[model samples]
Target chain A: MSRQASFGAGLWGGALALLLTGCQAGLRPIAALNQPLSGLGDSQSPSLNSNWLALISSRPGSRAQVQLIDRLRHAPVPLPGLNRPDSLPISVAVDQRGERLALVRQRDDRSELVIHRRSLQASQVVPIEPAGVPQRVSLSADGRVLAVEVSRGGLWQVDLLELP
Target chain B: MACTAVTALGLSGCSLWPLRRQPAAPAGLAAESRQQPALSGDGRLLASLVDRGGRTTVLLQERRTGRVLPLRQLRNRQPHSSPSLSWNGRYLALLVQQGGRRQAVIEDRATGQQHPLFLPADQEPQQLSLAPDGQSIALELITGGSRRLQVFSLAAMLEPDRAPGLLESGGGPPLQP
Candidate 1:
């Protein structure tokens, strides 16, 4: 073979090998967490921590309610006194042990932010000083700090509150 | 001549390669009706919003097994939204609507207890996120016709919920699955 032909063959062979390798590398399987659920009625607004998954789902007869799943056990954890028949859940956040939950719900024609202590079986109203409308909420890892989205004077702002 | 032949062969091989197939949806969930998805820090659980027959709700699924978990207390509540979970899937925080108003609440799976946080009468909550350790929370509120974000410290009131075998601030090799 001529010098030019030899060089061309080498180039083609190298390119083919590279292409095949690229295809193989791109075939990694998708993670199961990224996939969607089936049969459940209109499940949405998912939040996850290290070992817990929380979301709102409207199953057969229920309208909409918060659902908590233990990632390690692959089962749902029951929560008592959090969901009320007259209340509508808006947003949810969980702590590490699934002991403390921060929730926003609409009730009696008003919106409020509350901290629910599972062990104590009590709910405390987190008052936003200067009185603003609370929207979304997040809890720190230790459940020591809280981040709140508020609306004041028709403008949106973020507030950091100290929990006592 | 050899070079040309080799190039032709390469081209033919490329053409014969099959196209990559699109990934199929996980076994049962064929419809793409899910929304507002959140993943746990460990990536083992997923929470998302879905609508069924004009009603909106939340669903919690085990990422690896695609199993749907149950929420017994929330059965009566309708139109739930926004969800946040702790590191171990132990604490769950969410908002529930009551009449024409909304309230914030939390559920501790380990204790099977639910706690509700009440804001001032004038303050209205919009959205919220919980820290991984369940020590602090950030919330968005609307007051006086304006919106703002606030963070509250819960160290004084609640026990620290830490993940198992969690590393402090020290530097070390990342943990492997």
Candidate 2:
């Protein structure tokens, strides 16, 4: 009887240890994409779906570029005239369908909300209020409602910009 | 009698362990200094930023059960700035500063999948919103002098095997003429 009690206690203790470890593991990413983006002063901002990844990177002393990489094809899509050497990308949002792309670009103190339709091969720039500089941006799935965070005189405000 | 006393003592000790008492969203979180309450579409869950005891944490709580989800990833930050739940309450998007860059991340509750969304440099995400269809997310970034809005599509990210529908079929207006 004493031996059985000892075995049972050991089993319970081991089960407790395993349970604690599992809880401590927390959430983890299934896969982290490896890209050849480097040599920048800041970290890269990348948004990925299961297949495509849109990453923003700036070369040494050059303007930032938003590059789209196809995960299955393992190739980068060539976007001619998309990279503006004179302006910097502030933020980028891709739609669920990977059909639309929205980003904020800044030239000096001025900023504009740029929407790119991948399928149509066209883009648009919406003018923003000149009172403050545009910072972060998000677009709705249908590409109808746009939200921009603007800072004026040291205060942050959210601006909802509707696309026509 | 001695064995019974020892067993009771051991159980009591385990129950009193500090690790066993999980950290939760304290009361009065909505009244904190800077609170952003994001309620789910069905109004079943609410995700909010709470400043408790000089520290800021993002909490997701079930309205009826009063049970909070244990989001350990958000706890690593000194202050988890902004948290927004999706319309379906399946995904959560928030901002955190990791590796010296402020980026947004989306977490799936059921699968515990945490993926970081991309943003530009020096532009910290100030606010986050998931679209009603859960196919896109909106972020408001605050840079040095300007602020901008960005929308990321979840359809491609979520459904990689499917082909994207053409825009000319009358989905949305073209940005350029």
Candidate 3:
């Protein structure tokens, strides 16, 4: 084959190879959860560790609830005493092992922080005092650190809390 | 030789350009009235604000299944507002107005608990963001029509029963005269 022709053919082949590789990377699926989760509340604000997925959900005629699902079982793990008929569960964060939970409970008059440990079976309430009102709450993966978003005097601020 | 040089350049250009490109659109997310969508750290889930009939709600969806994971409408019966999600999708923060006053609230999505963080008496919080390590939030404060930026640490205000050393929490002891 002529040298120029050979070079052209090689270039075409290389371009095709490159194109294929790029297509594969772009099309690769990122999720393996094939089965659609059914009968769960419409989830919002999801936080995940390796084994657990947590979110806020609501059912018809009921207040908002926080749902923690075990990824392996795809079932809800009930968080007793965390939900009240009148109050709403607005946010949730679970520790690495899904053992510790940091959450926000909203009542008509005020909202409060409830940190609970599954193993300890104890829930602690931290008064978000002095700060204005809590907007968002998050916990470090280790469950030792807490972050709260607060609104005061018509402005927004984030408050960091260290839990014992 | 010229032909060889051209081929080499062509090959180099090809290497620089990706062969396949993924769609820019997020997987399976339908076009809706949703605004301010935040993806999880892993990009497997998305949280956004949806406005319907003058009501605003925060929605979460699993990217792969196109299934809307059940989330309670965070703004239902509350004021219509936008919220920011933490990088890990663990925390959601937003503004709420009650009794003619505005405030910020944080929700731990995992446990469905909500807490109120108090702001200064007269200053107003304009917007806020969570720090990546989930330790603090950068907040924009507005007072008397002027704006200021500030960083607030989670460890500083959340005084637990036991105190971790200042070095450990990266916060120094309170400054006193």
Candidate 4:
């Protein structure tokens, strides 16, 4: 075989190898259910008798979509984006009656807490501050209070606030 | 030269896997979650918060199956006037916040209207539960360095307060000053 032919074949082989490697990385599924979220994953699975709300990660690259699963049927629905545009879900929660939900998203270098409610059968959304990286949130039994857990300078504090 | 042949064979071998992959639902999940759950003390209903266009919302399921029927999505998705029940289960309550304030909404087993109860969104309230009479509610509230377990009379919570500022609960502030 000619020396040139051997060299060309080797080049083609290396190219193919690189392409396969890229595909593998793209297809890999990564779940970041680690240190940051605390035991949120376990505490807020679908089975808890209350209405379920979660900050579910959807296709990342295409869009950082946040999905809310109606625990009743396990179907996911999309939520609107944060005012920051690039803001993404950090934590999620539902009120006891499942009539309200709140999500904390980090955008730019700031944290923003957005709460949504379907009251009087009408839906409303608003951004609340002190919104730095929230770890977990839950609704009270009457769906009135919202308990928020936030880490400041690596220290954790739980805030029990009226969900106004 | 043999290395070239080996390489091609290796490439073909990898093609054995779905090299041109199709993105799929997360592993272990068979289908979209669609579960209308049973309400506390109530029989069967569904309730949850659903996110739409970056906005979040609470939803109610009024059937035994707890599934959002196809055409019903429209009515349910309507401007959602107030925290209403998705399904009217015997007993279900939801915590809601609107315009920087929080309120508790309780629903009976079979109605969608936001139940008129004591714990209206009139003042600051946190962690609320309906008592047996269904008239009263239990709440945990936080005010300037204090976390108090306040069980307000249902009627007091419903009616506008007599004095303004902060209503004092019986216990000496819970957390600390």
> Highest TM-score, which number?
2
lDDT of 1 at A160: 47
Q: Scored by Cα lDDT, where does model 2 land?
A: 0.55
Q: Can you give the lDDT of residue B96 in candidate 4?
A: 55
Put down candidate 3 lDDT per residue, B1-177, tens digits, no spaces. Answer: 533543343322212111111121244433343444444433445555555666666666653454666646355545535455554566666766655776666666667756555655776766554433344444445666544434444533222211122232436776575
TM-score of chain B of 3: 0.64
Where is model 3 more than 4 Å wrong at Cα?
A1-36, B1-177
In terms of lDDT, model 4 sits at 0.38
Error of 2 at B54 (Å): 7.1
Model 1 chain A poorest ten-residue lDDT run? A27-36
Docking quality tier of model 3: incorrect
DockQ of each: 0.02, 0.02, 0.01, 0.02
lDDT of 3: 0.54
Q: Put down candidate 2 lDDT per residue, A1-164, tens digits, no spaces.
A: 99999999999999977764543232222222232322222334444443454656555566678876565664567765456777788677655456667777877668866777777776666544436666666554444445555565665444444333
* Tens digits of lDDT, candidate 4, B28-69: 222332111122222132343444454444445432334542
